[model samples]
Target: MRPRSRHRVDELLRELATWEPKELRELQAALGGLQTALERESSKTARQPSPGHIEEKYIQRGNKRHGPYLYLRYWEAGKLRSKYLGKKPE
Candidate 1:
């Protein structure tokens, strides 16, 4: 087969880039729909009163040489929990 033309390849690349914004909009809409569905499900399955409002406590750690670090502590269960949404501390 003959090689593809450079001009044709550039045109196709430009078209692909131009399609990105529309694709992103579609993705955002789908995500919003999914979020709404999840919230509806959560509301239907409630067994207890919603947890108290989540609070974020930012703290700094580490030394000057190693560089300081920022962390978040959530107040729950009468304690300061260092995890967010069950995710391990980074």
Candidate 2:
């Protein structure tokens, strides 16, 4: 990665490092909720062949007015899907 990109990642890491215990717990709970929702949704639909793999990813959304927020990304049936996680607590 370029220096700028590395620096940006470092900055994000630093920001994450400053999160409070409560905030971390909130994020964890959100993740659990997401997992449950996925499971329920999948169960409601007919089973399909696995797309070889499934991945959970974090994505950053940039908005000039609202700053940035993180989202959860995943794949189902060879298609990409995402859900809004939450904004970093102030």
The whole-model lDDT of each prediction reads: 0.45, 0.56
The weakest ten consecutive residues by lDDT in model 2 span 49-58
Error of 1 at 15 (Å): 18
* Shift of residue 62 alpha carbon in model 1, Å: 65
Compose the digit string of candidate 2's lDDT tens values, residues 1-89: 57998999799879879999887755555555467556755677565433222233445457425524555554443454555656745
Q: What TM-score does each of the candidates earn?
A: 0.29, 0.33
Q: Which pairs of residues clash in candidate 1, taking residues 3 or more apart in a chain or in different chains?
A: none
The stretch of ten residues in a row with the least summed lDDT in candidate 1 is 66-75
RMSD to native, candidate 2: 13.3
Q: List runs of model 2 lying over 4 Å from the truth.
A: 1-15, 45-90
Candidate closest to the true structure, highest TM-score: 2
Q: Per-residue lDDT tens digits of candidate 1, residues 1-90?
A: 546697787787777676777665554444444454456546775433332222334444564242133233333435533323332245
